[model samples]
Target: MTSREQPSRKRPRSEDASLKNSLSDSERETHEDLIFIRPMRPLSVEPDRDDKFWYKDGNVVLVAGNVAFRVYRGLLASQSTVLDDLCSADPAWHVDGCPVVHMSDRAEEVRSLLSVLINGKTYITKREVSFEDLAIWIRLAHKYRIADLLENSLRRPSLQSPHHSITAVNLARLTETSSILPLALYDCCQLPVETLLNGHTYPGGRVEKLSADDVQRCIQALSVLGVQRTLAIVKSMDLSACGYSCRFECADHVSAIKTELLEDLKSPGCRHPLCSWARFMGQYNRDMTSNVKNSAHPMCPRCIKTVIQSHGQVLLECWKNLPELLGIEVEGWATAQDA
Candidate 1:
């Protein structure tokens, strides 16, 4: 007998098939929504309309971060090879059909650099530039390969205050601006190592800034110079030549001066006797040229004159060895020629 063929059974559809179909419908709806949605407007990076450098008729816009500068392309090209090459390579950077160039630089820095290039004058005059501003200007000038700006940056007044001196030293070292090193290092030697390391806060909460390595160098250099300075002061004293002809009185006076100087060495700070002597000598030299009487020392006039001359000689020796003391080379390093 022939067995009845078993009825064929159909295989059940997988739950995965239904899930996939639902996902496809959802994806289709999402795509349709995306197609209907309007694109967000591009953010405007342009500076204020009232900005001094902002030109309504400018042919090119330079965007540095969130700020945009409207300036002449020819001016930038004339000043910087790097900028010229960048703009030349990219002909399609535009905003609202106006050619735009994007730069990875701070707006303030770009503004300063552009101001100088366009106006033929720096935003801050060379005599009034702060350490921070000078540092930024020099760095940007170097980065943009603007040799004129770099040279102009170097011509700015050397650090005038001890706090700025710390900043100058670090900036000079960081930027490899060898021309500013000698004076900066000399100023640093006037300040205490603690002040150099921890920094001194100004009246407005602005703190003097220096690198750890620079602080260490200052400490080492000052330590060496302290010995040299003490020797200079002692050698400069002439006990026999004092107005007081009595040997005992002159001896006592010399001993007192030595004692005070030694005490200052024990707790050297910005106001240390050595710094005071340097300042006094500086003033004396200036007064001598002007024939003015501004000597503040209690020592006799003859003694004071001799001491200033001796200090001058000592400072000359220090200047000659300054680069070596700081563990750097003398070649290409700047020194105060008048020093």
Candidate 2:
């Protein structure tokens, strides 16, 4: 019952192994050329290896610290314009490095290019960047439509630098109409005068927050509130009588901030006509009247209206201007008019 042993068949080899041996000598040489080529890994703290990481998914390549050649090598060889642009030094002498290379998270240009590479778009940025190069980056980011970057820039705590005082002053001047945050803007009245002067180029620019002697400073600073409407806020707070009458110079300077100082007239029930007179003088300009074309005069009718509408003290205080209305001699008028 012993049958002839069946001839054993050769087992199939793995495709990888068979394919390896299938090449002729020269073909085998070419097979070695088929070595797996991965993309160069993004530079990091990790050690480098010959086996590169391929980026077939097409990501925004973030190449940092002298890796331009590697990044360029991976893509199809061209005239090398993109690589050259990245490698060249910044044309603006203001920037310290090639903003395109060694992409620091701090570099605005690199941040921008990185955003475009990864997110397929740009951003607007102008944060508290102190460095000239970073500032350029912020400007470019702003130009390129990177909104998040711009917001991030704005949200950054303002830098404290030797030139920050000057920068803050200039920023305030520039933002007088732009609605950007005011430089030394909030409670600048409380900052030290020496600090403000040493930091900024503002010759006569006084920081109000630090010095208490600056009533005019407060008025001037408050006048620049274009970004924030302060009328209602000012009206809500109780204002003390400014004792300019005691100081001859202070009384004379009253005309300088007549418009802003007029808010004092919004008192609850103080009807001294002199106060109303001063208030009327504050806003009663012929130019304003001409612009609005109200038939009733701003001073005569409005002043009386304010008197009638207010509580008893405010009414009496408003009517106190009555003697002045008829050109009668009021003793204080002699001094104030003389002033």
Candidate 3:
């Protein structure tokens, strides 16, 4: 047989007294310089009893993080295919008379999912799902394959702010729900390059970011949206320009609206193309009203109607084609104009 070198034995966690005794003081100091890295330990399976979700007659114990929820296996299996498969597997451990199944999820996430599964719509009196609540509910619902609950969450989304737009996009992608992507992606396009890179932090200090592909798509949207915004402004002016006397009499007033609109679109800073334009829209509205109030060069009511109506019409068309502009395809997407 060819001579083979034996593998060296690893030092025990406790220092070896015989090995220490065998070394001289200088040798021991040199040996002490060597560091022994401990192997990673497995995640803890043992969990503390949950105060609210634990039941006396529960047959299976779901351990999430450090909390355990003893809920019915039958009920969970009935609602979730993933849970059904998990329940059928033979558990390697048991707690009380119940089998202990380790769940790699936060305790709160598990609790939210269970709350809806058990209580149905009565969990909240009005069933108004907040953005945070929707986020928490949808993630676990999709992970567990609870189709009904996922559908329920999608239908009642209350995430009306741009702050959670990235989270909304992620959730939509995760659940394959395309209806939310158009608005969410448009909001993402509005974010500054810096904000897109740094990402938005939620209430719990968790940072939400777009995927690399989404970042690329958002970047692509910036220039296209800038061009579209300019075109829409131009088209609105054309369609809304009044016919005879009002057009000439309030020409300066119409000119002011166009000037402010164009200037608003040219705002600086690290904004993504046309992003800052929408931010100052209220300023335009204020200026229009204040000019009339000052009696300086008030636009005729008809002249004002031209700017407003044609602008609204052009924007309605833009809204319809928003998904296409961002290179996202959202099936069954429509603004009220379509309705």
Candidate 4:
């Protein structure tokens, strides 16, 4: 049967009773005849002897979907309270002389969970778990109340990378990992709106989807970031500290820089003969400190010092309000100075 037409095993009894009550006499007869005439086959079960996860001496067999994993019962029970309760509640559900625990999770998800639990590992090593594996692991960990697994999954380096920021946001929301949300949201702010809405595929062949809410947050944050970037650029263009010889030239240079920045904002791409404002905003968006001394613009030494100090102050203000800009509450974020 097609997935859409497949019967739901977990459908509520109230819905089933309501449907039965609504059926006409002829419809009821036809439904009963259909049920009586259809042949039901015994469930086809088999052991998955994949070398990656299967253990010959394991005590319990975990069946997730069509795949079976032979793993230690004690390890799983000790690590997961839900598993412990299940084993304690039913001591007699056995298949082929070994206890069989049927799980609703997919085979790969179960394998990822077991990789962390039974293998004497605190976290799945970066080499072992891909972005997709980490996402699934966090979900299963939260479902099964595996605290260590959930924590480790959140702490994985993959979640902190720029490429996986959207995935991190989705996983953070799913697992309620509040600490990672602010950083993930900040990273989302750096991405383009189209990339945020349509999702980006990582180099490892994992496609990450951002929710509509996440996309909206990015949109709002990007708008705020643009305003902040413009304000910072305009504030740094103050030429009062310029020397008498270069004051007028510096003022005109700053005006040209502002115009270039505004044009770049409209196009949202790097251009040849990159403007000072564009470079500064690029560093600013990445939350990096501005290096006025190395800026491409020609400014008097005194004016450069003034620009540096003003940009520093503006960056501090932006950092202070970053959480508010992203519509998230962040705790213990380092200031620009601290960074």
The model with the greatest TM-score is 3
Off by over 4 Å in 1: 1-50, 89-93, 121-128, 170-175, 189-215, 241-254, 268-298, 332-339
Model 3, span 141-189: residue lDDT tens:
7766567777778877484677788988899898888877877888887
Show pairs that collide, candidate 3: none
Steric clash pairs (candidate 4): none
Which residue ranges in model 3 land beyond 4 Å of their true spot?
A: 1-46, 122-125, 238-240, 247-249, 269-297, 331-337
Greater lDDT among 1 and 2 belongs to: 1
Model 4, stretches more than 4 Å misplaced?
1-42, 45-47, 87-96, 121-133, 159-163, 192-195, 198-212, 237-258, 269-309, 331-339
**TM-score for each predicted model, relative to the true structure:** 0.66, 0.24, 0.73, 0.63
lDDT of 4: 0.62
Write candidate 4's Cα lDDT for 1-339 as tens digits. 011233223334345456556778854554343222221432365655545766778888777767878777767666765565444433335555667666666777788777767654444763656777778878777766678777777777663456678878888887766677766777776776677778888655557878887788877776667677777767776766544455335566556666776677677722112123333434322123355523444544544455666677777777666667667775666453266
Error of 2 at 235 (Å): 7.9
Alpha-carbon runs more than 4 Å astray in model 2: 1-137, 140-177, 181-189, 200-339
lDDT by residue (1-339, candidate 1, tens digit) is 111134223223243245335556644443232222222344444444327667877767776657777777766666665565445433334665667666666677777676667656445463366666676777777666667777777777645666678777766765677766766766776876677779878655658677777777777776677677677667666555434454223344445666666677666452222333645543433225453433322344445565666666666666677788877665744344343
List all candidate RMSDs to the true structure.
19.4, 25.6, 14.7, 11.1
Best by lDDT: 3
